[model samples]
Target: MVMKVLFAGTPEVALPSLELLAGDREHFEVVSVLTRPDAPSGRGRRLMPSPVKEAALRLGLPVLESDPSDPSFPDVVKATGARYAAVVAYGRILRQPVLDALEGGWYNLHFSLLPQWRGAAPVQRSIWSGDTVTGATVFRLTKGMDEGPILSQSTVEIGPDENAGQLLDRLAQDGSRLLAASLEAVGEGRARLVPQSPGAYEVARKITGEDAHIRFDVPAFAADRQIRACTPEPGAWCLLHAEGGRDDTGLVLHVLRARPLPADDRAAPRDLPAGRLARTKRQVWVGTKSNPLELLEVKPAGKKAMKAADWARGARLADDAWCG
Candidate 1:
């Protein structure tokens, strides 16, 4: 007998799990999908369906476009007749009657391991902190923030050069497979959920523009981590500093891509002081406490993204161009 599954998600990160369940004919049937309603998007702020909603429509799955805060939410969930729900980045909390609405249970696929970075934006937080290890968790959905018992977990290495978007894409893919297997285990009545250890969890707060601000006073490695974590959203940026001037003047330059300081450059500040920018014919670099960080792509205010070296050339900066 195929189990009827209700899918709940809101962003592109959740698409993999939705697609995986929908494609499986032998085990689970995705009877319906619950996603956030159309919201303003893009530069024009026109109404647009969420990525999950768009994909759900493409998959021919019924979509419940409602928030948990709605008075009719529990009734709507009950109406679907899908006792079990698979949630991934649903962007809302499931409350009492709503949790009770699904008799079987609600299982969430979180982007971080339980008791570690348990909140929204786990992937971004992990990178910002220079955590070399992180993973995904499939767990029961409780009223608490990812405090439910763990159904399963899959550990993954944080690639040295990978950004938040890149790491998230990888986790979503890998987590989909893990979720499917866990669901299969549940179906076979062989699933065992383990309770997480108590009271040692870390918080993963959402990234703000200030959180993404590049600080040249930090070491090159730390700066690299923060930059990669904020990439592609609320982008990591630094203020343009005129020679011998402070960065308080609001001249911002968004850093789209950065490379690790090469071994040869790691110990050498060269002619550049901390927060200073300079470039050779082949590369652009920004000085840090430890070394100069290689700058690959950047976008000055009101400008399109371009190679950092090109921007430097066009600006015709002095040898000690400042970018604090």
Candidate 2:
């Protein structure tokens, strides 16, 4: 008794769950995959199929690309004869009508635990806020954002040095296993639904360019979290001040990897202004309010990423040079 499932998702994170459903032929049949339309990507802006679309095509599944605003969207879903819809990072919110069209309703696999990080950018927001533990949740779909009753969840520990990209990759794999089990329970009419408790809720808003700037006025740990959160996308960047007024305008450099120097290891004067730069024989440090951060890797505006020490040598920064 294989249940027919309508899969909806986009992006690389969604591929694992999509593939898992497609491979579970005994218990589930992926009738069709719904994803966002092809859009321009990369520097050349060439139209590209989403990661889910590519995977769905490779599995010999039909794909539908449409927004919720389309008048015929509900009809398209109804025609699939899919009783259950499993969504992950679908990149679009579903209207009530669309959810009603499905015979068994919709289920969404969110990257964060329910009632926390309930909006977009959950993985990035969790790391940005320095949370030590985060996990995935599969819940029934409703009009409210991630407010539906929980169907299944699995927790994962966040590594102290993990960035959003790495954490997401790991969670995606864990979530696929959880999603498969939940789908099986649903098909057998044995899944439990738990309502979220009343309490303070945090929203995981989308990240913007403004959030990518490294703020040295905060504690070293805070700055480190910001850099980790923005790594690999909308990268954390800082302006470098050149000595001798060679470039008073400053140069933009992306911070790829960094660590906050412990108080005992900090050698600079405590009163040094934030955003100042200092260097040892083999390492480069940036002053913050509480301590300095050791820049391990960086990428100049037009160059590939390299060791921060290498960039420091190329710029010939004086011992007293500063960056903002």
Q: For model 1, how does the per-residue alpha-carbon lDDT over 1-324 read when each residue is reduced to its tens digit?
A: 577889999999999999999999899999899998899988999999999999999999999987788788899998898868999999987887888888778988999877899998899999988888889999988788888889899999999999999999999999999998888887777889898889776799999988888988888888888899999878999888645455458478999988757658544357456788777676888888876788989999999999987888886666656886
Which ranges of candidate 2 are over 4 A from the true structure?
Answer: 244-247, 266-271
- Model 1 TM-score (2 dp): 0.94
Q: Report the number of the highest-lDDT candidate.
A: 2
Looking at model 2, report the run of 10 residues with the lowest lDDT sum: 264-273
lDDT of each: 0.87, 0.89
Candidate 2 TM-score to native = 0.95
Each prediction's TM-score versus the true structure? 0.94, 0.95
Query: What pairs collide in candidate 2?
Result: none
Candidate 1, residue 295: the lDDT equals 91
lDDT of 2 by residue, 284-312 (tens): 88888888888999999999999998888
